[model samples]
Target: MILIAESGSTKCDWVLLDTLNDKRINTKTKGLNPAILKKKEFKNIISDNETLSEYKKEIKKIYFFGAGCNTSKTKNNVHSVLNSFFKNSTSIVEEDTMAAVYATTSTPAVVCILGTGSNCCYYDGKSIINKSISLGYIVMDEGSGNHFGKELLKAYYNYQMPQNLRALFESKYDLSEKTVIKKLYQSKTPNKYLASFAPFVFDNKEHSFMETLINDVINLFIKNHILQYTDELKTVPLHFVGSIAFHGQNYISNQLKKQGLNAGKFIQKPIDSLIEFIKKENAVLQS
Candidate 1:
């Protein structure tokens, strides 16, 4: 059996393919990004033998694509967490951007991930040659759901929001800015709290404020994240994965086209492409 996962800060999608019978069991797991979960915290989640039996040990091989699994330190931390789950399974872990590349097939392409956070990588079909800055939540992460959510909050609290939008924001989220602020500043995992605002953006699609926010997010992404990678942009076409990128596809495509850059393609999920990746790899092994 082969166990594969696509993890963002918010959640993880797990697919366990039992090759012998060609059966697959799909599951959803909690977020295990080391950037968010410290080593001790991760240990408790995975090593909590009380619930391990539910996950089972039928998996023989494992592949993980995740956010915060970028640096070796973080990767090892995440690995330790997952190692508990994939106990008898051979696990290969890599950054979430690699999943975009593997799913997109490493063409001369720019892969953008816009879930809780954002990252852009230039893939050559063989390697991730370049990656633009993803300075986490405080600095970059422009064009991401969290970024849009944060902007919406600031607009509401700063007395800058129109009355209609302000009312909608308050009624929808039902969260006080003071509580939000304390959570964002004082919590162990602030990004998770900040990302919680994404639903507000989704719920208020027709609001002019949303349109402006989208435009601003797109502009900042192109300006600071994409165009900033001057040396790499010329090398490939752009492809995007994630809920926000897929939902805001038309707007993003139009924006990039306006800049005369051909945005490659967009997909709502990576599971299909991932299955294809495994099939192709299996073929190569057989050959």
Candidate 2:
């Protein structure tokens, strides 16, 4: 049996695949970014997950690709937790963007992530040749859900938002400045809290201001992250993954086309693709 996981700042999807019977089980848990959570907390999160507990001992290998597994220290933290959780299983920690690469295509391409956080990379078919240093939500989650949500909140609080939209936001969320501040500073998962507002933005995308906002956000992402790759990378297709990309596909596609770029695929979640990649790779190993 093997377990594969894709994790973002907000949540994680875990797939348990029993090779013998070809049985599969899907499970979800709150995000476990090693960069954000401590080892004990990470262990607790896994232990509390009912699905993990059910097959902890049975799992022979775990392929974990996550948001904060970029650095060695972060990877070690997650590795320690997984090791402790499933003593009989071996764990491999990897970056979330790499998961996007595997999910999108096997050939060389530029892969971008625009979910609760943002990142991009140059994948040369077999390996990642280049990538940006994603500075997390607070500093540089540009074009992500958190970025859109933060912009919306700022505009609303500053009275720059249209009265109708402001009224709609007030009526729908009933969130005061005090509540927002408390959640941001005191809450554990502030990124998730901020990203929760993305749905409202997408729903109002037809609005003039919304179109401008989305365009600006997407443009900034392309300029700052994806454009940094080598000139050779520009020749390949550009693939995207995450909620923001999937939701704003049309807008993103238009922006890319305007810039003479080709849009490849946009996946809201990469679990299915990850599952397929893992299955194929494991099958090859066995053969």
Candidate 3:
């Protein structure tokens, strides 16, 4: 058996492959970003999952691609935790961008992630060239869920959000300054907390204010992340992976066109495609 995981800062998707019977068992857990989560928390998440715990020994290999696993230090943190949990398995850890590349396209293209966080990488069909280093959600992650969340919060607090929308927002969430401050400053996963508000924006996306807001966020993302791969964009389509991209496809596509860039597929969940990609790689290796 083999286990493959695709994780963002918000959640982790797991697929257990029974190679002998050609069966797949899927399960999920909260995000396991080694950069954000403690070592004990990582162990607890896996141990608490009945499916993973039951199949721990059965899994001989684990391929974990996740956010915050870009650097060697963060990668090894996740690698060590997986090794400890799945005592019988050898784990391979890589950045989430690689999973985005595998799931989105095989040819040379620029892949971007717009989930809890945002990142862009240019894959030349051989190697991933990241032009900018992700400083995480606090300083970076433009055009992402957390980015949109921040925008909405700012608009509401500054009396910039329209009265109708502000009323709706206030009704739905506890936007007390005290509560918001505690969540942002004292929470373990502040990025995820901020991203939690993104759904409200999506829910009200048809509104004029939301339309303008979405455009601004997408424009910034294009200018900052996609444009960095200017040379690559001219030749290859720009691919996207994550919930924000999936939901905001029309807005993203329009913005890409304005920038004279081609748009590729928008994958809401990359776990299934990622598994297919891994299967092909393994088959070729065995062949």
Q: What are the clashing pairs of model 2?
A: none
Global lDDT scores for all candidate models = 0.77, 0.90, 0.93
State the lDDT of candidate 3 residue by residue for 1-287, as single tens digits.
98999999899999999977999999999998999988899889989999999999999999999998988998888988999999999999999999999999999999999999999999999989999988889899999999999999999999999999999999999999999999999999989989999999889999999999999999999998899999877788889999999999999999888988878899999999999998988888878
Sorted on lDDT, best first, the list reads 3, 2, 1
- RMSD (Å) per prediction: 2.3, 1.2, 0.8
232-263, model 1: which lDDT tens digit per residue?
66766778888888888888888887777867
Best by lDDT: 3
Query: Between candidates 1 and 2, which one is better according to lDDT?
Result: 2
User: 159-253 in candidate 2: lDDT tens per residue?
Assistant: 88899888898887858878999999999889998899988999999998889989999999888887786485557888999999999999999
The TM-score, computed over Cα atoms with residue i paired to residue i, of candidate 3 is: 0.98
By TM-score, is 1 or 2 better?
Answer: 2
- The prediction achieving the highest TM-score against the true structure is 3
Runs in model 1 lying further than 4 Å from the true structure: 43-52, 229-235
lDDT of 2 at 246: 98
Q: Please provide TM-scores, in order, for all candidate models, with all chains considered together.
A: 0.91, 0.97, 0.98
